[model samples]
Target: MTELSAKYGPVFSFKCGQFDVVVINQWKFIKEALANEHLLGRPKETTIPGVIEHASLIEMSGESWKQQRRVALTVLRDVGLGKSEMEDSIRDQIKSFTEVIKSSEGKPITVADKLFLSVSNNISKLVFGQTSAYDDPASLLMAKMMPEAGKMKFFNVQQFMPIIANLVIKLNLFNMTEIISHIRKFESHILDEVNIHKTKNTDDNSIKDYIDGFLHEISKRQNEKDSTFHVNTLQRNAALFYFAGSDTITTTLQWMMFYLVKYPEYQNKIREEIKQTIGLNRQPENVDRKQMPFTMAFIYETLRHSSLVPLNILRRATEDTKVGDFSIPKDSLVTFNFWSVHRDPNLWDNPELFKPERFLNEDKSKAIKPPYLIPFSGGRRVCPGESFAYLQLFLYLVSFLQQFEISAEPGKDIHLESVQNFVTRKKELPNLIFKSVD
Candidate 1:
């Protein structure tokens, strides 16, 4: 994108199928575009299957989007999304996670599998009011299929050529059929959970988790006309919550380990902060973030360095709009190139260098995240899970480092080059060896 931006300027146009997509590269333009209400719609529905209007949060727009997002936000807060309960849940999962690592006995291991169970369980508590054993069939299937979910973006070839894309999906080319089958199975599992929550019928009493709250709403609005809350909607949104909640956090943790292993000095600094602030007797909590600026700085630097979701999902222009000097037609597809914004030389002193101090203030007593350092794209459409994602990243990171040190296995080198898909992840991760801190 940097190369393309250099050649075609910041605002450039490209065609994907029957759609006209305008890519905004610079922070100034990208921010302006995202904030404009006229540019808030998602791309054409045929471009993304299972994302039809009201089908899921990402696919819906206008009233349906607003109602669903509001309900989700309120229920998440009620369930202690950013509070002590959530922290306790994550910390408990962290303990289980560490045991899995201990079972490895410092032997070489691909850590993502063990880590996903921990992360997913944290989300499961919020969504289903329960957690799953790492070896559970459903849990294992989710772990196996979650990474492939990223390919949905890669398979969005329908955006450029509907006929060919339809044929590709129909013919099972590129495992499209198999992928959809897995997605359906995943959705079925979510529906089963939703059904269980429905049977409990906690509506007349108190809402328990996200699914419980959703079911309560579905029961209340079952007869209402044009109601966005329903069984199918609940199922799809539940699946979305699982997908968004688990995959991103899991990938960020994976990157956190990769960087920590590559630069042991930063890991030492983080450990020192944890020792000075929380010490070893107690588990790390979300509240400790303020006392450990350096640790937060490291996490922030990783967010910027990785730019996990490189392009912040596709958006569509609701009406004809003018961004800078360029004119964007109504219904035009739009996307922000976060990778460019994070790497722009004009935005940072040395954009390519991995220096956490860059996020710290002059005296290093406070962490300063620049407005332009937008790992989560800004505006009304900004990630609703921003706070939750932050809490998870900090607590999980501190908890892991407090107990052990992560390093590449013997004879294996850590690779930093990322595979660009739905989420930016290391092309290949060496089996990490965990050494107990004590």
Candidate 2:
């Protein structure tokens, strides 16, 4: 960090290929970046091409971001995040995923695709109060929507280079207008959900999904003229759930199975513990996790090895700031070096090695440590879906591992080089064989 800081300076600028860019590292510097008024300041509908737009999501910088973040936090709590009710929804998705595996009849399944589908379905249900039973049209539509959505580049070229942007726009190079159309289609689906939730008398019944919680808040704050509360906000949030929920959990699951395949000895160790603790014929639950420490350790190792956001998303600096003699100017784009943190050699013994024991103990006295575990990133912008993510990952992993014996197919490997797009996704879908032990 010191080396990079010296070269970049606190507020110095650098060029990327043809575009100028700003980099920030210090925690305080980054926080200042996210508070910049002009950074996310455009009217929600007049947003730059290809980004998710929520009307009330205008760039407020300081107090606005803080207030909005608090509202989001409260909404998560009110909607039962980190509670048993959310766990039940997760378990239901796990059951759905298990059924998909069961129908495979000992064939290799696409681990990435199946997990993505399942995780997306689970979160969609929570966010929209609409459920998808795996291959439903809604699920299929979203699966199709995501990849294309990722390919659209609105903020990159335009935000980075305003001069070339005018040229790009004139030549009809990248269609900002089309991305909005795609967003319109996406919002259409969310509105369908919002309309259904309203018709269902779910408010009175307190159905307790994200949409329910958001709408309730909207009603509470309706009379407040300055509030950003609205039905469209609910729609955008519903769509955002699909964005936030699906990919990270899917990536983590892929790495989990990848390590298990590469290290059968560790796999056997986890299985042995699972058997000794709960045995077969019993459904896996969150409570079972505490008894299987080694199993949890393997999960952590996978997260370490699979640095999901290699470059991570950019945060804009709000003010001219100093970080150890460097001055990062206000409104400058900031890249959190989460990737560098994860792969820091000073933090790990042999950082490149696939060692689950690094998070557990080969010797009980000198316990293994997690050097840099930023799978979900951290701070104000840290993922809001983490509780649901852990629940989905836990239920699916426990249920699948306990019920099946997964093995790497002959000459095939589950590689971890998934290209990072809007959200990082597998370069190719992961295919793994499942042999039922049930």
Candidate 3:
């Protein structure tokens, strides 16, 4: 797409089976298109076989999308999404995560698995009101399942040719059987959690977690016509929260570690900033970010370089829409090529290079994140967990660097190339040695 964008201009459309898929390569067009109300729809559930039968927050359109997004934001805030309480929760998880690293005792160990579980536990605390033990069966299963799930192309032939895709699903071909089976198992797990939440005495005043808040909403709206709150939506949305909140953050953290080891100078620079701003005696706090510009810049640089969600969740045109001069017909699939934007030479100097200084100001006293960097994306359909993701990334990176020096394992080659999936990009990370800074 990035190569094609140069020849065809930033906004280009191509036919994919029965649909005209539009790709916006530049941030200007992406911003305009995403902010437009007519382009906010998601592909129909029938077109995506393995997705929840009923659309979750990511797939819902129009009023249902608005309602679910509103409720989700509210519930997230209620559960301390941006509050100090949430920071405390993440810090607690960070402590556990650091212990796992510390116990490695300078041995070469792959941290992705532990990182996945630690990140999952953080989300588990918000959605379930409790953290899962690293050895917990359910947590381990989910940590194992998430990466596989991320690799699946939920919008493949299914989006372009629904008839053939449906036939393939019915015949259990192309691994559709296993895909659907895994999705069903995931749904069943969420349903079990929902059922457990139902047993609790939930009310508006007694809301403790996402489940509590959602259950209360269901009860309040049971009598309303066309109500969107129900067991199916709650189950799917809960799963969405866990998946969205965990996988991407874990991948980003993995990239952070990879980069830190790859560029030890920057890692040492970040540690120095942590030492100066946060000190060695205490854990890094959210407020300290303002004073630690280089550290924040490094985090932003990793996000831009990784382009984790390269082509963000595909959006559909609910009505005929004009993205700049291009006319998008209703039902057309519109996606922004974030990879192109992040790597666009016009917007970034030496776009291919990984330099945290690009995000710093003249005196290096402040970090300047340009409007073009849309790692979490933008507009109404933007990631709901953006704030939460940032908090976790900042806390995890700062805390991890403060206590340990990360480097590649002995006699091992470090591979920084990303394995591009249909949705998110992942690193085939090498095992690294972590020596305690103390």
What's the residue-level lDDT of 203 in candidate 3?
36
Model 1 scores worst on lDDT over the 10 consecutive residues at 46-55
Q: What are the clash counts of all predictions, listed in order?
A: 4, 9, 0
lDDT measured at residue 83 in model 3 versus the true structure, 0 to 100: 86
Model 2, 429: alpha-carbon shift in Å?
2.0
Error of 3 at 213 (Å): 1.0
| Model 2: pairs clashing at backbone N, Cα or C within 3 Å | 10-326, 10-327, 10-328, 11-327, 11-328, 32-318, 33-316, 33-317, 33-318
**Candidate 1: misplaced stretches above 4 Å?**
50-54, 152-155, 163-165, 202-204
lDDT tens digits by residue: candidate 1, 351-403 = 98889999898899999888888888889889888888999899888888888
List the candidate 3 regions with Cα displacement exceeding 4 Å.
202-205
Candidate 2: segments with Cα more than 4 A from true spot = 1-20, 24-60, 150-155, 158-181, 201-207, 362-371
Deviation (Å) of 337 in candidate 1: 0.3
Instruction: Give Cα-based local distance difference scores for all models.
Output: 0.83, 0.64, 0.84
lDDT, residue 208, candidate 1:
80
Which of the predicted structures, 2 or 3, would earn the higher TM-score when compared with the native? 3
Ranking by lDDT: 3, 1, 2
> What's the TM-score of each model vs. the native?
0.96, 0.83, 0.96
